[model samples]
Target: MSELLQLIKQAAMEQVESSKPVAVMIGKVVSAAPLEIQLDQKLRLTEEFLVLTKAVVDYSINMTVDHTTESHTHSHSYQDDSTSRTTQPHTHNHAYVGTKSFTIHNKLKVDDHVILLRVQGGQEYIVLDVVGGGIL
Candidate 1:
């Protein structure tokens, strides 16, 4: 009886260990909207990486700004003791960086990753219905 009980416990442990991991991403459906997509708005996505043995998403973001200014002066004198001067104006420029994310149409959970699958008419993306789990 003790051996049978031990075997049952081991089977239960194995079943628990075999369970796959799941990730969920939540967002509204923006593709079917009347208005156009905004500048800083995220795109659409699918349902692939959410369910996996282990989900790993590698991403990075970086931003930088640069500026420069130059000036010069011109002077003229000696026409009946009169003098005239001129100066150049400075130069300035600005740069901007924007990052975009992804969304889905189907059931998007809270902790899932938003991944783009396919573009369906215009810029909208169809969701990926993943039945199985993830590997890498």
Candidate 2:
């Protein structure tokens, strides 16, 4: 019985050693090349790909101020335009300053900026980390 157990353990160890080593791919993830190129196939960029970029955007808010009143002639009420005060209803544009980062769901180029991936098996790879490509 002890010998059989030992044999089983050895077989398990040999199976583990025979398997392919897990590959660690650290670089940009580009799509599979064409037949002419004959490069490894990878994840391709699409029209709805996510990317980061820096941009300056301005925000404005519209506000309404009510400044209308109806005046009626009354003996008790004061009758003078100077005594009554009202503010003009107007809107002023406000400008926002500073640069901000925006997430864009657009197409990406062939080359990648930076990425970390793990090859599960064959041509399959899982993206671990990625950074935006282009000017920041």
Top-lDDT candidate index: 2
Worst 10 residues of 1 by lDDT: 49-58
Considering summed lDDT, which 10 consecutive residues are worst modelled in model 2?
31-40
The true-versus-predicted C-alpha distance at residue 86 of model 2, in Å, is 22
- Candidate 1 all-Cα RMSD: 16.2
- Taken over the whole model, the C-alpha lDDT of each candidate is 0.37, 0.40
TM-score list, all predictions: 0.18, 0.27
Question: 1-136, model 1: which lDDT tens digit per residue?
Answer: 9999999999987766555333233333233222121122464333331221212222343444344334434443434436554445444444433543433234433333333332322223333432233211
Candidate with the greatest TM-score versus the true structure: 2
Indicate the residue-level lDDT of 72 in model 1: 37
Candidate 2 structure quality by residue, lDDT tens digits, 8-119: 9999977765574656444443442320111246544332332222221123434444443444333333437668544444444434434445444333334543343333
**CA displacement after TM-score superposition, residue 71 of candidate 1 (Å):** 93
After TM-score superposition, the amount by which residue 134's alpha carbon in candidate 2 deviates from its true location, in angstroms, is 5.6
Query: What is the Cα-based TM-score of model 1?
Result: 0.18
What RMSD, rounded to one decimal, does every model reach?
Answer: 16.2, 15.9
Error of 1 at 14 (Å): 55
